[model samples]
Target chain A: MTVTKGDVERLIDASIGAAPAPTMDQVKEFVTKTLDYNFAMTLTEPFYIKPNAEILHAAGKKLCTVISYPLGSYTHEAKLAQLKQALADGADECDIAMDVSAFKSGQYDKVKEDLKPCVELMGDKVCKLLYFASLLTEDEQKRAIEMAIDLGFPMLKTNPGFGFSTTVDQVKLAHDFAGDKIGIMVSGGVRTKDDAIAFVEAGVSRIATSAAFQIMADFDK
Target chain B: MNKKELAKYIDQTDLTPGEPYDKITEFCKDAAENGFASVCILPTLVKTAAAALKGTDTKVCTVVSFPLGMDYPEIKEIETKEAIENGAEEIDMVMNVGALKGGDYDIVNDELARVSKACHDKGVLLKLIIETTLLTDEQIVKACELAEANGVDIVKTSTGFKKMLPRSTSVEDVQLIRAHIKPETGLKAAGGIRTTEDALKMIEAGATRIGASSGKDIVDGLAE
Candidate 1:
């Protein structure tokens, strides 16, 4: 099926992370071009463009800043501080990377505790939890989804674009685990319109990528 | 440098994606036994590495804005503080190479100063990774100068994450950094120093620290 512009726009979350810091002109260009779609800037180095959040928000764009991206290894306090800074800078959403290491070490409580503060801090703003699905076992991925759901996160994301791309099976697994209780966002390697459509067919609510503009442009053809 | 001496200069690292907890523990154990200078790990693993190396001289070193130096100065400061609280004795932060290349040296210097102050406040050594593989020689020299001026304790060569030029750690880069910095400033050669010969060449080129994942192999190769 040909993906519609509305469908692509609704499902796209243009992300800027895993690269060097873009200049202000680049940020402005991105904001202007992808105004119709959601934008996420990872809270890692380079994209800490919290200062530009106000401009993006004024443009009626939904700007999100991801915390402890690619590696949710920050201490609870650090993550909270990052979330607060992002919020103060005008971010409408906070996408937190789940403490996968803590979970893998069987420190489930620590993992939950790590997320609790950010969830509380976000308040009315949207909170999405990123679980590096490709790195976790099937059971672990399911449990992560459950925890995010229980925490009342608005969305659950797969991968931080650092590891493997989001697969159809992974998206389906998340959909099965979440069952519409929470939005499912698939990130990393959704490079084309076809890939995006396949994910949408798999029940993905959103797709986060650095290639959103390219994908959207490709879809118009 | 001999194997024993080389061990003292090594900051054994494993910043691999999806690195297991047990592997970090194992890295710490190996570092301690080998008399390595430090165990370089992710910020979250600092506490674990600290606990593992308790009473041992193997300091816990972690990265800030690691692999990519693009986070705001405030966020990097928070990361540095949290890392220190978790028992990180050394902080290896990637300098905002984008900012440097963009000619925003003020922002770059301010970031280094902020993180450096945080580390110095807790007596933690700070190493700034310049990602030399992605920079020209002039940019590399400028980065080292800025790092020294900003009070960074060590000037690191790369984060080992560069894929473009991918030169890793080289003797010429180490020599350039050593020549630019003060005598008191430390030079750390990281990225691709995978053999004993590479380690010795770095040391000979004036690197006081060598960051390598192949610490065991390099040391073993020394025996041969």
Candidate 2:
């Protein structure tokens, strides 16, 4: 069965990371072209910092910025500053990476503290915490998901597209842990429409990918 | 150079994506033990590295706008400030390659100046990664000129994420950058200096700093 346009749009977080920095024109092209198919534009901090958030918002696009990006190891203060700047730049959503190192070191308090400020600052805007699921053990992952739930985060993302590909098992783990309270976003290696469908079938609420355009095109076929 | 001497020029790096805290801790430990100049990591790890290397001479260095330096000037400046506040002693930022290549020197110069000032205000050194692998020799020279003119502390060669170009750091590129930069300004060779011999050749070609993930191995090779 072919995926509906609404289904593609609802489940896709169009990303522009891993590639070289795109020019303003390129970002415009991306924003304009994917306006119909993408749920939001997940841009790297720099690209998000460019003065296009207003335009994207005008075009009815949700501007999402990655905080501390692929490595969620920033000090609380640094991440706070980044969140504030992105918000000031008109970002409607914040996809932050949890401090993976702190989490791994069993410094859950530090990790919680690191994420707290962004959630507080984001206020009503969408705030999705990236857990980098492959880096964490089952218990750690569960604890992280529980913390995110406690923190009132509406979404929990897996992988930052840097480490291991976001597997269905990991998505299922998040799904099993979160159930319906937290929306799951699976990123990293969901490059094709089939991958996106597999993830959606596995119970992921969203798919973060740099190849959203290609995936949507493939779905049309 | 001997192992001890070579250590002074190394900025032990682990900018690997998704690097864990334990690994960063280990990298900092190795850097301090090896007498390396600094431990270069993603900006997120600056505080951890600073804490790990406290009381040591090794500095805490973090990347700004990172492997791809296309962020707005305001963002880079903010990132530099945040890094310094988090205990980063040095900032290695990528120049806007598209702007530089497009001959938008004004945009490039302006961004560098803003970030350079942020680093200088904190007494933190700033390195501009030109990503030599992606540029023409002429573009490289222009970039070096802009970097030196803007008072960047060092001009770095690559971010080690060779996407569209070869990732190697050539001695000739170092010489070319060294040729354009002032004597006081340093040159850092990164991206592909994987061996002791490669590091030495870069140093011989006038690189004052070496950014490498293979710091331990390179230092180990120096012993033999």
Candidate 3:
């Protein structure tokens, strides 16, 4: 079981989000670093989409922007507007945040309604439906996966990482439920190469992390 | 300041992610009864807070683009309009921090102008959150200038989201922005303001409003 740098890079979704805001230089440096690693994609906010689009495309790497972000409290209309604009801003993928409160409150209809238009707008693009899996019940996780599959989202991202920890078991659960019908992206808390390897072995289709460089640096050691 | 007077300067907040509606309604009821300035909440709960605080003096303040503030100006404007329609009296819209930090003042100005117009069109007060913890002193002053130029009614400090770097609002942040803006423009100090003393320091530094989750405790501390 030898893990190489390419193994890590092939499955890694390198991400760099500054605490409050990122300067153009910081964004540029990070994009360059991620591209140097030749990771699968770069997860960024909508603000960086247009500025980083050309470089990301030239490298044949995807640019994913999260709408509604770590907290999915925005209304359906707000989510739709952000999704439309992010795509217009040249994002290759839009990871739509789930309305966790509505889903947690048993307002399944409201959650579905909130995501329907976003999924429709994303159409054939890589739309990853993100859920704060660390906070949900098993039934809730299942429902989220099923809904994403039904809504035609190609990927399911577990958690948005701003303190939310995505367990290997959660990735396995999503993999078991979706099979090959939906790709599973494990986000948040995968800070080490070993953590990434465990998730990849657990059937995770991709890994999104702010610690991509650290994980790659630790690959041999 | 006494409890009653201090209460008028506080925006009782509960932006905890995934908080239930019932809890928000209860929190709003409590804040309204306590006579806090407003109850800052997520956009989804603005309607609930509005209903709970109806017939009370406390206004409903909701966030747009929230902690990140990186959304396009158009989306921020849409969020402002929707929150206002849902009964938000005051909007704490996150300024496009990335634009401001990237030296893209045009993008920052466009966002401020758009959200300001949306909020002002509905006669809703707009507080532009600069996330002071992330900026340099110079950037903070520039942010105040851009916020004022766009007709922002208030300049807020942070989203209090507990970021990777883990910074908080300081009295100097409030004072710096206060000194830069016109006297008529309001200043709000949020993020890590938990104690009565913390609230007073912000007010002393020229903060006209305080956004805190511990509004009740601060007010009660003054009461006792």
lDDT of 2 by residue, A1-221 (tens): 65565686677878764445455666666666666654756454544344567666677767777887656655565567667777877888889888787677788897788788779898988889898888888988899999999887999988877535888999999898779999998888988888988888898888888888788778678
TM-score of 2: 0.89
- Worst lDDT run of 10 residues, candidate 3 chain A, spans A17-26
lDDT (tens digit, per residue) of candidate 1 on B84-133: 98899999997777788778888888888899899888898999998887
Highest DockQ: which candidate? 3
DockQ of the two-chain complex in candidate 2:
0.33
User: Model 1 has how many clashing residue pairs?
Assistant: 4
lDDT of 3 by residue, B87-189 (tens): 9999999888878878889988888889889888889999999988888899999999999899999999999988543688998888899889999999999
Better of 2 and 3 by DockQ: 3
Candidate that would win on TM-score: 3
Inter-residue clash pairs, candidate 3: none
Which ranges in model 3 have alpha carbons more than 4 Å from their true place?
A1-3
Better of 1 and 2 by TM-score: 1
DockQ of 3: 0.64
C-alpha DockQ of every model? 0.41, 0.33, 0.64
Error of 1 at A19 (Å): 4.9
Ranking by TM-score: 3, 1, 2
Give all candidates' CA lDDT scores: 0.80, 0.81, 0.86
